[model samples]
Structure formats: C-alpha cells, structure tokens
Target: MLGGGGLVAANVYASATEGGWGGQSGPDATGQVKSAGMATIDCPDVGSRLTNVPDGARADVDRALAELDRQTASAYQQLQASAQALSADPHAADDSVMNPLKDKRSATIERIAVAIDRVGDRPEGLESLAACALLPGQEATGGVTGGTGQPTATASASPGGGQGQGGAGQAGAGQGGNGPVASDYADITAVQPNAPQPAQQADASRGSFTSDCGVNANGLRNSDNVIVAPGVSNGAHHFHDYVGNQSNNAFASDDDLAKADTSCVDKGDRSTYYWPVLRLQNGKQERDAGAPGGGTEGNAGQIVTPKQVTLTFVGNPRSKVTGMPRLLRIITGDAKAFVNGPANANASWSCTGYEDRQLKDKYPLCPSGSDVVRTFHFQSCWDGRNTDSANHRTHVAFEGPDGSCPEGFRAIPQLVQRIVYDVPAPSVEDGGRTVPLFAVDSFPEQLHKPVTDHGDFINVFDESLMRQMVDCINSGRTCGAGGDGGASASPSAGTGTGSGATAEPTAGASGTPAPSASNPSELPRTDATTTPAHTTKHSAPGEQDGRGEQGTDDTGRRTKQGGRSGHGAQATPAGAGTSHSAAPSASQAGEIGQAAQSPEPGSGRTTPPPAQSEPQAVHGGLAETGANLWPAGLGTLLALSGLVMLIRAKRLRY
Candidate 1:
C-alpha cells in the first residue's frame, strides 16, 4: 500500500510540475493533462488495512513528498517575489513571467487534485493535499488593466523594448476610441511688425488747371464793352485829326494847342470818349390842311416847302481840336452852308430865305433819315501860331457832294474855299519842310471800344430781392400785406364754436388748471413801453383767481392771444398775453398768433429761437479774470511742446 501511494504521489508531482496546463505551450510538447478529484476533502473515507512498507517504497514516498515540498515552496516564493517586485517596481509582472507562471500553476493544481484522488485511502495523502494550496500563478496580477508589466526600455530588441510597442498600442486605442487631438499654435504669418507701405503717389499732371488756381481766364473778358458804328442815340463815338502853323513867332496851332493846352478840350485825345446825340423832325399831315378852294391860285392857299437841316456840336467837356479836322461831310455838298447855315440863309434871298431858314429850324435833322451827312475839316492855325500857346489859328474846307445829289446837280462840291493859310513850322530833321505829328489816319477800324466803357447806361438791378418777391407770390402769400389774414393761425378748442376758444387741448396739456384772466403774469416785460398799467391794478385779483384754480381740470380750456386768456373783453396781465394780441390790428393777428404758438427758447418745447448771445467762457473764473490767459503766444508754446513730445516718443520706440 505504501509503494502504491508513493508511486501515485510521485507521478502526481511530476505532472503538476509541467508548464503547459496554463495554455502556454513551450517547445517541449507536453501532452494535455486531465483534472482530478478535489485536493481538499471534507471527510476521510474508510478503506482496506495498512501494511508494513518496503525500503524502496519508503524512499520513493519521501522523495515524492520532498519534491512536492520543493515545488510548493518554489510556487509560494515566486508569488511573494512577484508581489514584492510589483510593489517596488510596479511593472515587473511582465508578459515574460505571466505566461509561464499561468501555465505551470494551472498544471500543478490539476496534478495535486489527481494525486489526492489516487492516494485517497492512505494517511500520507493528507500532507499532499495541504501542499496543493500553495500553487504559483493566477491571471498575471500587479499591472494596470491593459498595461504591460515591464519597464519602458530604450533598446528596441529587449523584452522591455516591447514597452514602446505597448505604449503605441495604448495611444492608438486612446485616439481611435475617443476624438481628435487638440493643441494651440499661433499663425505667425499674420503678424504685421512694420508700418504699412505708403499710399501710391498720384500722377501730378492729371489734375485740372482752373481747379488748382481757383480762376478761369475766359470769365474775365465777359464784362468788356460792345462797340457800335456811327452811334446809337445814347451811344459813344471816337475820331481823330491833325493841323499845323507857320507864323515865325508862332504860338501853337490848333493841333498843337489840342495836344498840349489840355484846357478848352471838348473830346478825348488819342484815347476815347463818349457822346449822346438826339434829333427831331417836324411835318404837317394832310388832315391838318383845311379845304383849299377858298385860297389864292399860285399860293395854293399859301403853299409852303418844308426844309431839312442838321445841327452838330460837342456836348461833353473833353472834346479836342485834333479830332475837329477829321469831321468831313463825305456825302453832302453844302458843307460851309450847313456849318454856317443860320447865318448864311439870313443874307441870301432875304425874307424868303429867312422863311426857309425858319422852315429848316422847324424840321431838325432826323438821325434815322435818309438825307443824313457827317462833316470833316482841317484847322491849321488859331490866331496864327506854330508853337503851343493860347492863340492857335485853324483852317476849314469842303470835300464832296457825293452821288446823292438832287436833279441836274454835279456830285462834286460846287465851291472849294480855304478859310485859313499859314506856313508850317520847320521840321526837326528837314530845315525847310514841316512834319505834322497830329495827322489823322483815315482808317476807321483802328478805333476800338475801350474796356472801361460798358455803355451809356448799365441796367443795375437787385436779383435777390426779385427772387424773394417771386417766391412769396408763388407760395400763395400776399406780397405786400392783407390777404387771407388768418390762414396761418392755430386751430381753436371750442369745435369752431363759442367765439374761438380751442376745441381740443394742445399737445402740452397735462390736466393742470387752465390759465385765468386773474393769474399773475408768468413772464415780465423788460420794455416799459410794452408793459401795461392795468397789470399793477389787477395784481391782487389775478393772484387770487390763479390760486383758486390750481390743480383743477380747466388747464387748456381758453385760447391765448398776446399771452392773454379771455373770450373777448377780459385780458390777462402784462406779459401774459399771447404774441397775437400785440399784432396792433386784427388783420395781422393770425400771423402773430402762429409765430407765438411755434416754440419757446431753452424750454426743449419746440423749435428753439436762434442764439442771440455769444457762449459763456468754458474755463473757470481764473481764465475769465486773468488778462493773459489766452495770449496769442501761448498757442505757439503748446504747439512746440506737442512736437517735442512726439519726437521723444518716436525715438524711444525705435
């Protein structure tokens, strides 16, 4: 019985020591082992009797027991070592130890069970049961849930090297199982550390000429004068001429006098001047003649021939003798007779010619008539002189009858007569010959209108006042006064009834008592002339009535006029009446009323009145009292200080 028990225990110990039972199969192909009965028994079983055992059996049993003890001790020691390693360096229960320990511990537990079953009737089997409790491996313990039990290694090939692999697997799991990685980094490219580039320069040549200088050349000449030929009735005309004298001790000729004397001048010199001339004509219409049968034959009831004549002379003080010679009658033959007509007609034909002269006087030359003529003359001497002096002599002559001569008459002048003859002064260069410096050029185009002369009469009128009047008429308002007198008045409160009290409350009403005729004037009139004496007389009555109506609902009942509250007769105190009451007349009352209803100053009530005074001083009383507080020099000081501060700040920054 001992030999059998010893043999069973030895086989059990050998099987228990195998390493494949924990599913870690090594290169040594250990066969699969079967499980046995429970190692710990609750109750001992009764069996066959015990016998004396041989020495070999005893030795084998001792050896089996010893081997079992060694295995059990080793298993317990391994467990303790793992526990200590995990405590000291918590990663020691790595896969290298865990896999082998799991297989061996599982196998030993199975073998211990089998040994217990095989030696069930023997007393020594109980010791083997106790040793089975000390098996070595359990699910390799001493590490985080999915962590490898090893130190992180720097080398790639060691057992610890797999730590990096394990870590990589952990990281992958963390990312895959969760969400995206997060971090913060600045976009350095967007940072601007330098000043912005200066704006592109503009093309200097592209701007406008008038815009830069603020004026246009073409506009300057728009106001110059317009020149008309011959002349209008109230228009200006210009002419020029020359003359000379030969008296040895000669005073100036008329031309020299004109150029040098300055006095007795009736026209402009070489420059320009203005003249206005008017002409009149006379005739009797056939209706003015009575029936002619009662008149004599040749007379035809005293037949008359009307006459035409011209009268010419300077009207202004600036006329000169230099221009007189150029006055030629280029179209008329009787130049001398026309010039001295009033004198000559009286001598020729006696009373008949005088009658003709009277006829000519009746019909003054018409400026627009077809028989008009202009005259030109040369005056060479005045009282016989060649030098500039007061007594210069002059000459006169005739030029043309022109082609307009009447019936059987020659076109040339019928008489050529010289009114004066005198030798000219010696020329400065040629001793015997004289040069006429004052000679007139026949060309009419050289005489242009002067820029200063705008014309005889410029129509000067006020455009702004005309525009205002037009606007007023167009807007349906009376240009002068008194139209629809009350078109501008405010509406009344009494539904257009009860003699013009307001039919509705104004926008400002708040249920306070309406103003009474007896109320004390809220505003005092500064002008003594405008204030009423009745205000002082009714002061007591006004105050008493105002106090009684306080807090009542009569606030907006009556209409106000010139600040006065009443139906018709009763009036408020001075300054209490609306502006309308001061309209002086009922015709203008509505206009004044509308103006009063508009607004008040500083009350934030309606459109404010224009500011009538300059603003008060902004600084304290010190500034107001000090004489030098705002001296002109202080502005320069402040500007200099600002410039210095700006320079300093810029330097520090750089």
Candidate 2:
C-alpha cells in the first residue's frame, strides 16, 4: 500500500503538469537542422488571393508577422545573454540567477501568441498561406524558425523493436511500428463483424478495394514530414498523421517507401493511412517521461490511439471501377467542421453504440460501452486518367443515390477510413455532459481549435493487391487483411469486368511503386493524415521508470511504470492514468488492454465493448511540480521545469 501510494502521488503530480512549453534547450543537432530550415517568411501566393480578402487586410497580416519577427529577434538575443550568464554561474531562480533566458523566451512566445490571435481572425488568408507554402510553411521541407523562436523538434522516434510488433507497409523500406497486440478495443468473447450492410457498399455497376490496418500510434506529428505529394515545398502549417514507412520523413523518396515493411498482417498490401491524433482534455497526466508535474489545471495525458482504422476504395455507383495509382492520398472528414462554424461541418462524427446519436458537439464522450470514433469516406468518382487535381480533391467525387458518375468523372476505387479510440467513461457518473478532448499540433497555436484536427493517407498499395481488393468488392465478397471481415472472397469472385486500362504501368517511369510514406502531397479539403515514440534527453523532477526506482528520460515516450508510448508516450488520454503502473483501476486495466489490441472488423458481430466502470480512486501527487509559465522552485528545479516547459511549448507549435 505504501509503494502504491507513492506511485499514485507521482501520477497525480505528473497529470497536473503534463503540458505547456518547457524552457529547456532542445537537442543540438535536431535543433540546428530545424532552425536552419530553408523556408522564408512571406506569403506571395496569398497576396494573389487579396481580392477575396478584405481591403488592407493583407497589410494587417504583414504588420502582424513583422511584429512577430521583431519580438522574436529581441527575445532570442536576450535569451542568449541569459544562457551566457548561466554558463558562467549555474544559479537559476533564487540561488544566484533569475534565468533571464526563460524570461525572454516566455516574453517572445507571449508576443507571438498575441500575433497568432490577431492573424487567426483571417481564416482564408491562413488557408491560402497553408496551401501556398508561404512563410514558415513546411510542406515537404521542414519549417523555418523565424529566427530561433520555434520550439525544438522533440526526440525522434526510436528504431522499431519491441514486444507485440505488427504493421503493414508498401514493401520493405523499414520495419513495422513496434509493439504487438497487447490489448484489443473491447472484450472479444462476443466479437462479430462491424462492416456496413451489403446494400450500403454495393451497386450493380461499381467495384471496390479495401484493407484493415490496425490502430496507429507512431506516425509523425510534424506537418513538414509530407507523406503524400512529391517534391512539394513548405505548403502547409496544419498537422497530419502518416504511416507505412517507419523512416518515412519529409525528404523520403519513392524508392525509400517501396522498400518499407507493412504494419498490417497482409504483407503484400503496401498502402499507408494516417489521421489526426486526438487528445483527452478532461484532465489526465503523467510525470516520468520529462513532462512537468503538479498543477490544479486538469491533465492532458498521453496522446491517444484512434479506436479503429479502416481503408476502402470503391467505384462510382454507375461506372466500372479502375485500379488506383500508387501514391494517391485523399482526405475524407472535414477538420474545419469542428471550427469555422456549421457550414463546414460535413465530416462524420459519432460514437460506436450511439450511432443514432451523431455528434455536433466537439469532443463528445462515448456511451458507457462505446468508443469515441471518426469516419472518413473518400470520393468514388475520378477523372479516368488523372490521379490528382490542382487543389487535390476535385478530381475525386462521391457517387449520388443513383450510383453514377455524373459526367467526365469515371469510377475509381473509393476510399473510406474509420478510426476509433477507446475512451473511458467520464468521472461524474450522474452527469451527462461530454468532457472536451482535443488534438494539439505544431500549427494554428490555438489549442482546442477543432479545425486543426485532420486525417490523411498516401495509398501505396501494390497493383496486385489493388486489383485483388477491386476484385473482392466487385464480386460481392466481404474480405479484409486476408481474412473474412464480413465474408470471404467469394468462390465466384472476379464476376465483373474491370474499368480503366488493363495494363498497369510500372508505378512511375523509374519502375518503382508510386509515392507513399516517402512521397505524399497535400490536398486542401480532400485528404487523410503516422509516428513512433522515443526516449528524451532530459529527466523530470522525481521521475522514475516502470521499475519504480530506475530513472527515465522524461520525454513522455517511456513511463516509470513501463507504460510506454511514442505519441505522448503510451497511455490513455484525458482522464485516465499511466499504462506503466501494473495496478490500474479495474476499468482502467481493461482499457489498457483494449486500447492495445486492434479492433476486428466483422459482420454485425464484433468485439463487445468493455463494461463501464465507476470512477476509481481520486489520488493526487505527494510531491508537486508547478506548471506555471514561470516556475517556482529552489534554483535547479526551476531551471529544469522551466526549460522543459519551453521545449514542450515550442516543439508542439505548428
């Protein structure tokens, strides 16, 4: 009980101080590369769209950015001076120093924060900036620092290797994201299929292709690591998810991904899918992995996994479907729906068992037995020969009720991706209000801005798998990852003749698979969006590994209790506790296992949702670590905490 008490205290304190910018310096090499990024500040393309903007608004934006630039430079200079002082005398805070560096850094961030607020008023301008890869745009190139104001990139994902590892990728560029099926979404005693009804997917003249990639937690959170289009410059500030190649990065080439291993069970399937990572805001936190400790402000625990991941490509209702080209990444749900008001709320939102109860509220909770979920269904109609459009989405359109491609659009495999998260029930049993959860990223700085959440994908499916998927759906066979998701590939499959040309080109003229994890393009409203976790260089105050006494890197990737994660470190988000501790509440224990396991797609019968549990013990940390922008500590702790916060803040900025 005493040992348990200590563990509980650590978690509570950690939870209280999970997020916020830390004031520490980032890794030297990574920092230098990100800082030296070649992007310049200027949105010339945005100026072209000025007519759509209000008169003189362009100047306002310029002024605001200039202010950001000016403040940033001053703060940086001051920060350097403070660092020099610290070098001469390590005293920080009361001991012998005031940590002028932290002060200046905070001031700079505050000024930038204000500038961001003013610019946020102009949504169109931001979008254009994102689309055009203007100032600080990342696109394929990593972003510029605006002169060292941006936070350093967090620790890189470690090389994949661990227990329960499984992932599907294009070919064999890299190993699958590590960690085997430690848990499933729910209890499997009563498991069954979760596919749409036959009529919902079938039309006499169309065909489809589909795969079931399990939940992903390793995709990079950086927006600059473009995984879709080829050789595009910094064109976006928004964040997205990526998959397939483990080493896939902003500079990854097509050949790199083609050699990557698959994360799914189907080795032949080489497609990559990604979506926005979600965060629970009702308060969850941990302290071991470099995250701060102690705060009354509820916790923002570990980054969460989507409950489910489903990928499908179908044809327009009236036309025969063609096999898709290799590197076609598309978006389905409207991230902007959560922001920019109701007009853009076209993306689907709902819980598992509460299907009838579609969610209009941002971050709605799931019913007692259901999971938090989001679904993205791409267009089925395509322009016969082209794989993309200038804007990225217009080339593909959905089929109407009649099952026909309206005009020039011919049928291609339509894609539908459904991602689910095993969110636990709220603490207040009596109340029915949904606690707010959010997804934070490097862009848009406005925490909890719903529009910032988005999903994307780059289909690198080998043509054989593509044709097989097409054959499976056209023939009315319900199949998945080489298994019977709803039904087996029909004995009489290949019933319908295919659309498009019979001969598939050798991916590109270079004779490689199309662009994928190594090559992805941004599609404005139409796209989807992977990363692994790594240990950090810094350790938090009173931090320990899962073994209790062993030290940890405090990077939030590995926990003291051995509950590790790459994205926010492996653990439940929002109201939950760490996965490292062996003794989770009865309900939490179940959640840990469920979240670790991949949800199986079956006919109406699927894994049964775990029974809801009452709120467990309400414990708090014994030793508190303050989360204030300006930390209060006895010299050393202050420097450490403040430094960590600065790192957290800037690294997470978009």
Candidate 3:
C-alpha cells in the first residue's frame, strides 16, 4: 500500500531514488543514441475500478479493456521509436502519440459504456479516463549513477564474459533501449531484515498441502494472459514461464483448462501456474527475440528456466481453511505497478542464504553458490461468493491485520510460490557489461523493475484432490502426493518447508517419472508418478532458449530452496516492520525436522513432522498506503494564504 504522499514522492523523485542511469552524459563515446528522459504513456486504470460490471457486459468490457492494454503497448512502442524526435520537441509526444492513443481509448471506452448501459446502469467517469500523458521513465542520458546517487562511470559487459568501455547507454541496448541499468540491483547482505512477526493463534490451521508440479522443463512459454486478455494474443506483452496445465492460451476457457493434461505429479491437480520469465542480457536472442512479446516488445536476452518451483497451500493462522472452488482464478501482484503505482504490487525477492531480508523493489545480488528467489504470496481470503470478480480482485481478499478474514470472506488455502533460478549475480557497478545482467521479462514501459514482478494461478484441481488439500490443511497434517512434502528443514537452510517439490520438466511424450531426490528435504521429494505427457510447444517459432542449453536436473537435486516465507512479509505492503530475529520460533520444534543428510536416490519418503511454520500469510485486496492528497494540498494552500496576510499587515504597518 503506497500512500498518496508516498506515491507523489515516488513519482517526483523516482529517478533519483530508483537510480535512473539514463543516457550518455559525455560526448566521448559512440554515435547518436536515444537520450535520457525516457518517457512512457500513462492512462487511468479502468479495469480495476469496474467492479460492478454486469455479467452480460463482462465479455464486452473485458475485450475493451484488453484493447486498452493493446493501445498502451502500441503507444509505448511509438514513444520509444520517436525518442530523438520527442527530445528535440516536447510537443511531438502529444501530436504523434498521446492524442492518438487517447482518441482510440475514448472510442473503446464508449463501447464499454454502451454495452453496460444495455444490460445495466452504465458507469460514469470512464470517459475521463480516456486521456493519457507521458510519464518520466528514466533520467536524460547524463552522468551514470549507482545506488549512491553520485556520478559514476560505467563499462559494458558482453555475454562472453568480456568487458569494455562502451557508451553509457550500451548496457541497456540489448533490452531495446529500455532499462535494468546498474542502479536496479542491490546486494542481499546489505538489506536489513524487515519482515514483521505473524500473530500466534490458538486455532490456526497449521497444516499444508503440497502439489508436485514440475517446473516448465518442457518449455511451455507464452505471452497470453487468459485471465485478463482472453482471446487476445500477446496480451501480456511479455513472456511467461508456465507449469501445470499445458493447454492454457489466450483463448483457453475454464473447460479447456479443466480437460487439459497437468504437469503436476498428482493426476488430480491440473492447476495452471505462471510468472514472467527471467532473462540474461547476454546478447543471445531467444526464440521470441523477433516475436511480438519478445524483442519487438523490448524483452530481449536468453530465458533462464527456474532451477526449482515450489507450490504449497497452507492453512490460515486465524481459522480453519475451506476448499477453493474449481476454476478459481487468482492474480497476485500488479504487472503494471511501475506506472500504475504500488497499490497492488506484491513482489518479494531474496537469495538462498538471505531469506530473512526480503526486497520489494530491488533485485538481490546473490553471492556465489546462492540462487535468486522470487516469492509470490497469493490472496488467502475468499469472498465465498463468485470464484472470480469483475475486477478479478473483489472476489478474493487478504485477511485483516488480526489475521481474520474480512466480513463476507472466508479463509482458504494460501498459495505460496517460491521460484528459484541459478544464475550468476550481475555486477551492477559495470552495468552488467562485464558479467551479463539478468532481469525479469516486463512490458517495455516497465523497464524490468523488480517491483513489477508478479504471478498467476488458475485452480483446476480435481474434486478429490481439492478435497484432500482442504482436509490436509484443516486437520493440521503436512501432506503431499506420496511423501514429497512430508519432510522439512530449517527456514534458514532454505529447504523443504514448503509442501511441494521442485517441478522439473518431464521428458519424452508420455511424461517422465518424477525425479528422485537424494534428500527429500532438499528437493521436497514427489511421488514417482508421471502424468500423461502432452506435446511440448513454444509460444512461437524461435521462442526457444538461445543459450544455457544445459537444463537443471529435472530430478530433485537442488539443496538450497526458499526460506520459510512468513505472512508478515507478504501482508505488509507498506514495507513496515522491525528487523526479523534469527531465533527459531517455539513452534519450530514440532513443525521442523532434523534430517541432516541427503537420502540416496530412490530413498523412501520421510514422513515429515506434523505442520511446518505457517506458510506466509497473504492479506488480500489493494492496501491503501499514503493518505489522500487533497487535504494535504489544502493545508499547504491555507498556510501560504496566512503567510500572505502576515506580509500584507507588515507592509501596512511600514
């Protein structure tokens, strides 16, 4: 939750605080390049506010909203291409991009209003949302600065481990002149522990259900976002790494997903889980390099598959959990938070050894032997009404500050996604030119900010499996398919406190057997079960891995998993909290295990102790951060008026 004052401050000093390493500062470098003061189009977010949309008009409204996204992407592309022209004449942005985009949006918005009016009361103020403006993206290419905000020199690094002095903008050329410059990264050790402690409850649902969904080993990549832009191709404007349901696409309906084969080891779980792919700016073009959601959209570089993916559903700390309805679709975190603000932003980043200290806006530079971790704590409170909402958020809400659901909402299994990637930490000082930089795929306008990272899930669990999950969680049993999630480890060790195992990509046509882990705790061993395999596909031709062909062991061999993500980290959107203490909780003795050594391959599943630490709790709904700006603005105006009166009285006395 960002307050109005904070939002204003963020917008005002974003470049300085976010380390806007803009274009070249001196003429000592190469030929002409896009100068700093990078700008992107910003329009009012209409979809989020349309909560009362009629079901009859849902289709029309959704399509129109998707059209809005399409319009924004196009305008952003035009802005990037016309950077030099806009730099020469500020008015050029409006004449060439802003005005045209507003016109298109106005027409689309009218269609929405008309459709709504036919079935119900049409919404007002949508027309006012049609206008757009250029937001300051990056600083003008000038003196490069690091996190310290002081002038600093920069060198470019090639993918081949080679480094050389290049133009200040060279570090971002691979990203289509967008961002993720040296200032976007911070060392993990430098971040102090900031997560607050969770409330202890007497009747908490302490158990969890783990689903062993393989990582996207079979290479299912796409840019379509079925929940937001159904039937529209490249709706996401960025590539997403997908696991679980194989048939998901832009046109996928609930039925299409329900009938699809799953990548989860359990046959009953066909849920689809996905998030934006992480890429290394190593100069190698991926399969989507030339495609709409790839290079054309400014998402360049090689895609790096996750070394591990953990999907766990845990009980609420305040109450027993209920089953999530079939076909439930939940989206956590806002993809467009950079321009839209951090109202719904929920991205949490950390490293293997430094899990206590989580970062919301900056990427962590992991030390050697450590992996980068991305955690998404989905909304845990359901409204107990519709499985989905018109705004896609109103149906589900996060619990209250006291860990209880808001009125009309019920506690449900909280889905905590912990994805691990094994890539060398980028040296932000040299702008990752010497050691290639890595970034999460993002809309061209987002500039690949870590805060913009998000994840999506559509629950397609079979009735029986869904029931089992509810039962396991409510009864306080740590259960998973076979023994995959029955083992646990120290949260600091970053092992299998989660209920699920790493989703390794399966092999061959009929699905490969779930890989055996030497230590079930290290890998969160899944049942040696294999689902019926489906044909492997990429979103488009050349959307394949451009480099790093060596796949991580599909077998559960990863030792360093994610730390026990507490609800305190996910629930506090304001980034408020005391520095977390490393002392083990009193409950850890019962929830954790002392398994010290890795089991041999094919070792039996160890029955984990009853309950692990409560899976991180996710407070749902958009948290209002700063206060409204009008009051503050009024106060400032009144004070200025008083000052004028005082000055007039003094003048009269003189």
Top-lDDT structure, candidate number: 3
How do the residues 1-654 of candidate 1 rate in per-residue lDDT, one tens digit apiece? 333444455455445434222211112122111111001101111110112223233323323332332333233234333443444443444343444444544454444334444545333443223212211211111111111112121211111100011111011110011000000001111111211112212211111000000001001101011122121211111111111111101122224323441100111211111111110000111111122110000001111111111111111111111212221212111111221223212111001001111111111111100111111111111221111111011112221122122333211111111111010111111100111100111011110101011111110112332233233323323221111222222222211111111211001101111233332331212232343222211221123333122111121111122222211122312221231111111111122102112123222211111111112233224765354334323444555666677788899999
Q: Which stretches of candidate 1 lie over 4 Å from their true place?
A: 1-276, 279-371, 378-654
lDDT of 3 by residue, 1-654 (tens): 124444445455433323223322222243112223245667888999899988899888888998898899888887777665665666767878899999999999999999999999989989999998777545333222223222223322121011123322433433455666555666665565554445648888877776766556556778889998888888888988778888888999888998998767666788999999888776665667788888788887767656567777877877888999988889999888888899899878876545555677778776443467788888999988787888889999877767799888899898888887666666444455434567898887777878899999999988877887888777777667333334322121122222125222111111111233421212211221321121111222122223212122222111112232211111111111221222111112121111122223233222111111111122111332133344455545555666677788899999
TM-score of 3: 0.68
* Error at 417, model 3, angstroms: 0.2
Which is the winner by lDDT between candidate 2 and candidate 3?
3
**Candidate 1 structure lDDT:** 0.19
TM agreement with the true structure for every prediction: 0.11, 0.44, 0.68
lDDT of 2 by residue, 443-545 (tens): 2211223333455666677777777777765664445432343332211212110100111101111111112231121101111011101111233434442
TM-score of 2: 0.44
Give the TM-score ranking, best first: 3, 2, 1
Rate residue 117 of model 1 by lDDT: 44
